[model samples]
Target: MITVPDESGIVPFLRAGPPPDRTRHEGWKRWQDQRDKFIPAPRLSLEEYAALSPRRRALHDLHRTATHVNLGLLETPMSAKVTKLMRGRLRNNALNFEPGTRDGLMVSGGGYLGKTETACDAAATFEALWRDLHRQLLPGPIPGTRDLFVPVAYCRTPVRATPKGLCAAILDFYAAPHPKTLHGMVRQVADSIRVHHTTALLLDDVTRLRLHREDDQDTLDLIRELMDLNVTLVLIGVDIPNSGLLRGGRPDPRTGQWILPPVKPGQTFNPGAATQTERRFDLVDLDPFDYDSPKGIKAWLDHLAGIEDRLRLLQARPGMLTEGAMPEYLFRRTGGIVGLLRRLIEDGCTEAIDSQAEELTVDLLAGIPIRLGNLADRDPTAGEIPEIPEDIAVPAPAPRPRRKGRNTVFDDRGERPAADA
Candidate 1:
């Protein structure tokens, strides 16, 4: 009975006094105070703060502290897709309509893509929305009803790539005081969903499900259980191939598999669809952001500026590019991928901080880390170089002054900078 991290416990401690463990209570109080202080900070809009319940707020903080890996740009197709999916769930009041499909989800993309952040963002948003809706549902001070949003019954990373271990891990999330068997865990999750009427089982890294040698029968069984029980499953990692092998179809256990989930009739993994099958395993592919389009480029840059503004750790200010300013420098640098642009800016910011600089200029950004070159090589649009830049300083000399003689004069290299020297 391994104790899963008590993410939802903070709210309870804040609401009512915990058991008489003076030291634990003191620590919990301290945590609550700190949480409260930062939550209503001036930066957060009143609406945003109002929407979050204490428990959801605490969970947000925990998730932020643990998962805050600069989520560069939110305008990318991948980012937009994530937003769309979450929005759909909210629109449908999926959390409110329980005995909901617990079939789970899978987010796949290339490397350095923002898969983790996508998951965290979705989790945070879902929790926030759930709390808001729950508050609305219970207008009065309802007795015997919990104020908190859906609790994370179990959230484990890299679900062990093996079925038995993954099942055990999920069961363990219930802990000792609660049930430990799979069926029991399912029941517990179901009850939690009804209790708060909002609960989710987040398997953050399900890319390992496609292990070649490892029989997926057990894995499929567990997924079936989750679906039957109405738990939301979330899978995040790189793009799985056609056969569903995530790690390039490698048979090595180290490089996991990514097979297509078993689906019911007329159901597909398309993110654009309104409804899906009974075991609705939604597929959200986070395609690299398209910085190529004018609109996409502006959105990407604005998002970066916004992030920088939020995280004051940036020592050098990005010059003159106002919140809405779309600089060709940024647009070109990002190669249209918001994630890459963010990496470039953050890396540049870190260097500025180290050097104690005042501004991150085009000069500084020149050396900043970029994958655009590689991206370009992979680009179907990269045509042959028509003209070179004069800024390179290796002057492609204009037609040199011809000698008085019409005869061509060769230089020592036997090649001509001019037809006649």
Candidate 2:
């Protein structure tokens, strides 16, 4: 005879348990430390700066100061927007996740504008929050369960951006084997995501997806399927219009050609037939740094000061280099692009060190092998600095031809007559 358990007898097991002791849990402690690792860099004391080696000191000050500015205040608005969208999706999933309801974020920017880094930072924050929420709701591992529940899944978009490839990538993130067929892979990915209880998915470099391909529609549909499982999607890519991720028409399978949206003369091309999945994304553009802005100028000054402080400890003072026409010169040369500015500074530092200059000067900077172009007239009143010395011209490297397919070896003799055949 078997005993049957009553509701009253099982009440303790079914009731919500007390919160787990976070300090005692090694996993939670590790996660807490990881979250705290991204704290803003604090200013170093004089003695501390003096103790670092010359190379370490230079590289540290350069990266820490520059990255702090670019990734901190300048990126706050975009970061907040991403966070709001992600949190809203999470809330919707908890409350009422309707079918065909997919809220996504699209981060677009020019090349080298730090869009990838910004998206990654946002993803890290979301993962941390997800971990905290899981701990609160579920407390700890379930009895007889060997796998850990991962709420956030972040991955780069597949290079060959087909529907099958994307599904396989997601399955790979969950450490699940996928079937060879496209439909099979999709089913496996959906099952893995559900089993893992994933709440969000971040795909970076989505520009790799080809436009006007039949598979593109399949990829979009797969994304909708993922969203139906309550996963918030975030895509990061370059600001290219109509790359199939957004603002593009699908290929017509019958004709095997693109079915582009028609537009009248003088009217902008707008696709009125976008599916709910394509229209659900909220687009955010990350602009390059404005060197003319007061805030931007201050950021430059802070970076230079950081470099100077570190250099001073090595007995090579970069006095007054951060002032006068130097900032204007840097802005004109690099056009306020963060990546270009970093390269200019790194190369300039190397030149200064090689020349044994006690103080970095305007002349020393002009000599660095930097490719200068037409400068933007963002600030007319900033006034002209001395023309970059004519002799400082470093010829830009020749552009490489874009690779299309397999490598080809050309004959030395051009176009040999086919008459011999």
Candidate 3:
């Protein structure tokens, strides 16, 4: 429904739109916004839609655009793996009430590989369950205290990250006070986590940390100390393993796995000492979708199918994206990157809705430019459909059951106990 008119007509609607993209979305308030936003475009019967007035229909069209564009990040096998591993670690840490340092999780991947979204998704889910179990309240709050039981804190490793800046970022999440001294700030961080009953700490964009800098090394040390705060520290960044984030710790010669000598809780490590974090974190790399093997091909197809099912185009065919060369065409265009595929589909859907094409075609996608990240080769033949392996056949997902309209015309209510509503 359109908003009521003011002194002017519906011009107010046109005046407002989403804010600047540069605004950080990792804050608690902004993160909650992302978590709670889900607006499904209405699937109206042709007759029902035709009955709307011109203004109402136009407003509906505006709604359709908003819904399609922000359909939200779809779950893929990649996000599932991250969520499972992360939640498992968080649960494990929560159960360990002993004094030893809790282990953490690191999600490493290329840019636009849905690393932050996956980590955040898992964190948010864990927070919801935690809140429910605690009845949405932290136990034993001082009377009349306005404390928020945050459960999860998300922060980006500063662009020019340092130990103090890192501490500030965590404190900033809770609007906790910052101290002038690095030691004081670190103390504030631990105290804040305890006060808020935070269970998971997500430090994203860790690739920005440079091991060569002394302040960066101190920051790494601070991160390990934060782990002892009894929260599962989840480090998310682009190409973390290669980013020198796991430096200082040496890999075992025989086992060929990262290892470090354990440090006692509350003890600071020598700047040159082996990183206490390397052995404690289960570092998982999130790879982009693969199209080379049978299993890989099936995963790619399944991903496309998931997107296809969510499409609200009135004229969309059942297999608009899953069937024929479209999937492969999309794969080539996106290079199996989830972010790129989403952009391609969202843009295509927008075009389809406005043009009345009602379905995605190769030509429509061809006209749509996908901004493959800075690294792509920009190959001309990318738009050309390549043949996928013939053997692996992926079955389409079962169509979801539609909800039957209610019979509101029935006269009997509670008076007729035997009749269905």
Model 1 spans with C-alpha error above 4 angstroms:
1-78, 90-104, 132-154, 171-198, 215-217, 240-278, 307-343, 365-421
Candidates in order have lDDT scores of: 0.47, 0.54, 0.70
Q: Write the per-residue lDDT of candidate 3 for residues 340-408, one digit (tens) a residue.
A: 778778888889878888778887877777644343321222121222222323334458799998878
Error of 1 at 23 (Å): 25
Clashes of each: 9, 0, 0
- Tens-digit lDDT string for candidate 1 (1-421): 1111244354322223532221122332243233322321123343564477767554443333222233333555557777677556434545455543543456666645666556655555565666566679767445895343443343443333444455555544443234555445445544554554435555644544555544454465455445544445565555544324333212325423223344443332222223343444556676654556777666665665665554432232553344322355565555444456556665665565455452466666666555334433121211111121123222232486776855546535556667576
> In model 2, what lDDT does residue 163 have?
79
TM-score of 2: 0.58
Q: Compose the digit string of candidate 2's lDDT tens values, residues 1-421.
A: 0121122323211213543222122333343344333333334555765676776555445444333332332343434565565566555654454554456567776555566555655555656676778789887887997546766666666655677788776776676887987767766776776787776677766776665666655565555455545567777676634454555544446643233332223321112223333325556676554666788677667655654554322234454547667766666666655556655665665565455463456677777756434445111221111122234333343488897886557536666589966
The local lDDT score (0 to 100) that residue 47 gets in candidate 3 is 76
- Tell how far residue 367 is off in model 3, in angstroms: 0.9
Residue 79 displacement in candidate 1 (angstroms) = 2.1
Residue 242, candidate 1: C-alpha displacement in angstroms: 4.2
